[model samples]
Target chain A: MGNFLLVTIQVDLYDRLALNLEADLVQMVNKTGAKGVLIDISAVSIVDSFMGRIIGNIASMSKILDAETVVVGMQPAVAITLIELGLPLKGVQTALNVERGMDLLKTMIDESPIEDEQEYPEDDPFAQ
Target chain B: MILSLSKDNIEVVREQDVVLLRNRVKEVAVKIKMGLLNQTKLITAASELVRNMLRYGNGGTCLIEVVSRGRDNGVRLTFSDQGPGIADIGQAMRDGFSTGKSLGLGLPGSKRLVNEFDIKSKVGEGTTVMILKWANG
Candidate 1:
């Protein structure tokens, strides 16, 4: 079993910065053969479509590294906004809290493919 | 008009200032719908417009107004920049269309998020973007 990587981001939930975060997380997962990754966003009160896209992108990239990505502690308000915007979280798994995400990831690592079925679409409008 | 912030004809100068403006817009949007996920789209669009004013216009003021339009309450933000205007307004609106590396989704994405979008630009003059969105009521 590979080691787990936990990265916590405590920044304002904006677009450009979120893109930077996604890139960083993707790079970390690739660099370290971590079995799973847990993202903590309890500090963020708001999230937008651009940020959602970034999270979705990270989740998609994690699968390539054979690592599972899970988002933990998303605020209710932020979740609601994401639903309204139609921003699909795509390959990422989510837990009510970090502990739960860790448990879920552990289970997946032992059983089915830890990598999620959802893949990033090639024709994404926001593709850089 | 549920929320409106009018500056006494002053220009906003600074990158952080743009974030603040975006926060205010988000605040209003959140109030409209306690569970609105469009905050990301709204904030992204607002950031793009504000960035345009600060980068191209050098530093121009903006008036942000949120109104309840149609079935949903939407944000109506106007950014007026007094900088060198665009030569081709149509070309500027296209995606992957950026004056710099910062993802040119400013004009197009902002237009997409809102229900109504209007832009007026003139060469050697200035540019004004008016964006409107109706809440999902």
Candidate 2:
């Protein structure tokens, strides 16, 4: 929980709101320096292709900032709609619920191999 | 033998109208005793098309109707817009084809959610999209 950011989408999000959330979530990741992000969408009933793109974008953006994102609690209906919409949510991790999402995120972060000390010499400016 | 039960009209003139349209679609789907998965498909398809109307067509009119063919009942939606019409209907229906900043899934994706999908567009006049989803089918 210390290095994780949690976001729960409780309402059906309009286009503008969904876009804004994508921007804000990425900003939050940068600000908090969180290692992982968990987005709960169990309450959201619809996931159009646009919304699907936003979720995918969030995952890609967070990964760029060295943060892993796990979207959790998707309704079964929503999942079917997304697939029918031709958005399989590739490259994005998903979980059945928040608890599982958190555990998955933790495992992802923990399982990442530590960088070898020799790879980044102390004199390398990028290492800092 | 498709018989129309009842119908309503909604104007898509703004972003909120799309949201309102989604809710209205759900209401109609429920009134027809549509299943949960069918309702979700209806609402989601309505949301995608209505938003397309707002974005490309500068808003339009949507006619929502309940229809029955034999014993099977379904919801039908028709969206009409008098905006800059699509130049190529064939290309437009293809997935991943967009003139806007979107994923280009609205038209094709909406088609997949409904039982029937039809589109008619004239270059200078306008574009119309109609879709139907049966309650049990």
Candidate 3:
């Protein structure tokens, strides 16, 4: 809530809803300038390849916007299904639950290197 | 060696039908006492295939059946679409090969989630896919 945005998916999302969430979540990240985003899907019972791609897309988009994403509370069955679906959710970080996910997001945000602009000045020979 | 205990048909005509199909599959899975993991797998596979029917097939019909072989029980689903049939089913079954804006895991991925899978299609005709999941598998 401080520098992070938290979203909990409590329903079995349909295709259209999942797509809308992907769009809205990315927009929210841009609008709020949140450092980290947590998506809690514990209540979600299934993660088809489509949903899997949406999660991956969200994480990648958030990364491009300078925000880290952590997907949390995935059911064990859903995890197994995703792997079998050949969607390993690459590039997306996961946590056991929301609390751990928040901690992971904090660590990710804290450990990330500062912007290069602040570390290098125009007058510096290496600033190119 | 499989006997059909009960059968029903679901018409997949719109986006909402996909959701209805999944719920019906879930109901059948639970009726047969399918394990949670297996139920989830069955429902997910149903979701993928039904969406394929709606997207590529321009909607279709799904047949739900409860089947049994010896002491084993399972749910069998048949999705038939009148849309343009696949030109190359072999290519379609390969992972990451989609003609649509998707991850391309619908065919092959659904195959992995169930116990048995079969597909039939003819270019310009239509496509039909059948899948079965053993309750205990």
Q: Which has the greatest DockQ?
A: 3
Q: How accurate is candidate 2 locally (lDDT)?
A: 0.91
lDDT of 2 by residue, A1-117 (tens): 699999999888888899899999999999999999999999998888888899999999999999999999999999998889888999999999999999999899987655444
Error of 1 at B115 (Å): 4.0
**TM of each candidate vs. truth:** 0.62, 0.93, 0.94
For candidate 2, the share of real interface contacts preserved is 0.70
Say which docking band candidate 3 falls in.
Answer: medium
Residue-level lDDT tens digits of model 1 in A33-97: 68788888877755554466677778778877888788999878566555544454666789999
Give the best candidate by TM-score.
Answer: 3
- How many pairs of residues collide in model 1? 8
Chain A TM-score of each model, in the order shown?
A: 0.79, 0.87, 0.87
Judge candidate 3 at residue A8 and give its lDDT: 93
Q: By DockQ thresholds, what CAPRI class is model 1?
A: incorrect
**Models, CA RMSD each:** 7.7, 4.2, 3.3
lDDT of 2 by residue, B1-137 (tens): 88889989999897877778888889899988999998998888888888888888999999999999999999999999998999998898999999998988999999999999999998778889999999997
True contacts kept of each: 0.16, 0.70, 0.82
Candidate 3 residue-wise lDDT at A70: 97
Score residue A27 of candidate 2 by CA lDDT. Answer: 98
lDDT of each: 0.70, 0.91, 0.92
